[model samples]
Target: MRLGPGMDYAVAEFPVPEPAPGQVLVEMAYASVCGSDVHLVDPDFHRPEMVGSPGYPGHEGVGRVVASRADGIEPGAVVLTVPSGRFGGCFAEYQALDAGSVIPLREGDDLPHVLMAQQLGCTIAALAKYWREGMRSAAVIGLGSAGQFFVQLLRARGVEVFASDVDAARIAFGREAGARAVHADELAATVAQAHPEGVDLVIEAAGLDATRALAIELVRVRGVVGNFGYPEFQVGTFPTMAAFRKAATVEWFSNAQGEPGQWCFHEALDAIRTGAIEVGHMTEVRMGLEDVPRALAITAAHGEGAAKITIAIRPESAIFEGS
Candidate 1:
């Protein structure tokens, strides 16, 4: 399929390849639509490609290792593979993965299933970057999949968390995910009332310009503001002077850096497996590969109804028929 501008996807037949040394072939079972995928689909964020060359785009995918040149990852092993920006092809039925980048999934492992690994990893990395000792209050702006995950992480760490979103449905979802849900318009007042001295941490997962500024304003002195959302191709202005004066640390997290080199995936997996984070609410939508294009559009246009949209690639008969 071609992820070209104005063309969300176009089917093309191709031959399946064998895994090379130290690599594995994953028959993808599920792939989640990330905020970055939406950005890539925007014309403003468009990048030129080399003539006649194909670029595969996808990072968050879960599947079973159907074939491998490595030892422990033999056939039928469920795993999560980290494909680099250019050659990472998770949107397809079969994805070639480097052995080192694959994390094995045990049989009946509820924690590391297709629905949990990718988002959990990203959330864990963001939390690790901004979490602090003695921090007791947090506000998560934007209750998308990431924001919901942040709410769970904060609450798990014993912090009082409030979640805000323009969409009421999203706010309700946040509440179900264990956050004190509030609307965007009421966020400033909510934070002010909850913390009085300002919240200890403000996680800007909304990617809106207004929310970005609010994150800076709502954070307490010496508090941390972590920006984890991928806003559309646009720059946002914030109260830099106030943030500086308050000694607030504004950190921008990109999952682009979290593949194999960084422990983003592993950290998220550990958090999910240990119950330090919750993924049940995040997997709100499930569809098959045929729904990829529409799923992307729905996520891009109206993200209020979903936390995470999982794309199932394998049939139930193939994975657990006889068992």
Candidate 2:
């Protein structure tokens, strides 16, 4: 597919890829649309150099191994794989992946739907970084796919979670996912009334500059604020002074290059397997590759009513089939 300034996506036939040494060829089963994908499509952020040789733009995909160089993962095994860079190729029918990037799906575990695992991993990493010892109360700003996961994860961890979003439908979805939902404008007061000391941890998953400032405002003094959202535009004014005076810690979480270990991905998958966290509700809309452009448009324009919109690559298969 080619993504340009005035263009959306144009699918074209290409030669099937063959795995090289230490790589695996995956037959993609499902791929989820992410907020960052919307940013990449924006003309302002799109860079000619960032586009790959084959020019595929997907990072979150679950697939079945068609061929592999590794010994443990069988050819028939299902797995989740992410591209090493921005040009990572998950949007295609077949993708070549390094063995290290492939996450093996256990027998009887869901395979086709590993997007949940990928998303859950990101959320768990953020929570693990900022969840505090004295965190009796928590709040998550934004109820997108990741935000919804954050809400469920926090509540599952025994924290009383308060979720806020500009979209009312998302707020309701948060409530359904076990969070006490409130509007973004009303979040501060609502949380203040519920916990005078304020929430101990506030997670900014909305990926908007304004929400970053709101997170700093809602957190208690000496508390922690975890930022899991990737804002498309540069952040103008963060509440630096308030954060400093309150002795708060601001942590940024990204599954991309900055991290050294793959601990978060493993931890997230395990949590889902054990039922410690649930990601079922996040997959609100499921479409095929042909519907990707429309799905992306909906996610970018409509912030609520839909959480995680996944593209089903394998016919008659769930995103996570074995699991």
Candidate 3:
């Protein structure tokens, strides 16, 4: 699927590329539609790489190394691929990526389970950077994929999480993930009732003007406000008067930081493998490659109870199992 400006997309059949030296050709099994992919289609939001130029617009997936011109990654190994750059994308039959960008999957790894490594890795990186010790509570606005994972991560670290979302299913999922879930309208009042001084940290995962403002409003004086969602348009005023009055620390994170071998991706992988993190509620929709354009449209509209939608590129039998 090729993505262009303003809801433009098409499925174009093309010959798969041969892997260059130090790279591997992967037969993509599953690819998750990211929030950024939805933003790239907005007419007003001009994504530099996607606007005007038609390119594949996906970054998270798992596949088998069909052909390896690399030293470390072996053929027949199931690996997680984080696609970036002009040529990198996984919403297709096959993808060629640098070996360093691919992480070998272990035996007993379920396809859907490992599909969350990149997304969870992103949350892990951000929380690791700003999550403070002795912080007892947090308010995570927007119980989407990132927010759902945030609730679990915070609770695992011994922080009480006050989660809110417009969707009832999401609120239920948040509660299942160990958060005190409430409706968006009741978030402030609920948090205030729990901690009169406000939560120690406020995470804006909804990526909307109201949610952003709510994050600032719900944080205690000198507390941290972490913006995890990427909105297509401008959200709230940056460092507004209210934020200034509270003197809250505002931090923004989009990419998953830290070394692949050390933090983030590795940490997320370990957590998922050990059952420390559960993503059953994250990928709310599942489709196939032929449904990519439709899936993008639904995700862009935030419709059909969709949070994280995954494209099953190949049949399960075709996906190589680590043997």
- Among the numbered candidates, top TM-score falls to 3
Q: Among all windows of ten consecutive residues in candidate 1, which has the lowest summed lDDT?
A: 46-55
Compute the lDDT of residue 4 as modeled in candidate 1.
57
Candidate 2, residues 117-166, lDDT tens digits: the string is: 77677677777778777678889988887888888877777889999887
TM-score (C-alpha, index-matched) for candidate 1: 0.85
After superposing candidate 2 on the true structure, give the runs of residues whose Cα lies further than 4 Å from its correct spot.
1-7, 52-55, 256-261, 316-323
Of the candidates numbered 1 and 2, which has the greater lDDT value?
Answer: 2
Per-prediction TM-score: 0.85, 0.88, 0.90
lDDT of 1 by residue, 39-131 (tens): 665555544451122214556777777778987778878777765443456667887778876787656656224446666677777788788
Tell me which residue pairs clash in candidate 1: none
1 or 3: which has the higher TM-score?
A: 3
- lDDT for 122 in candidate 3 is 84
All candidates: CA RMSD in angstroms? Answer: 3.4, 3.3, 2.8
Whole-model lDDT, model 3: 0.79
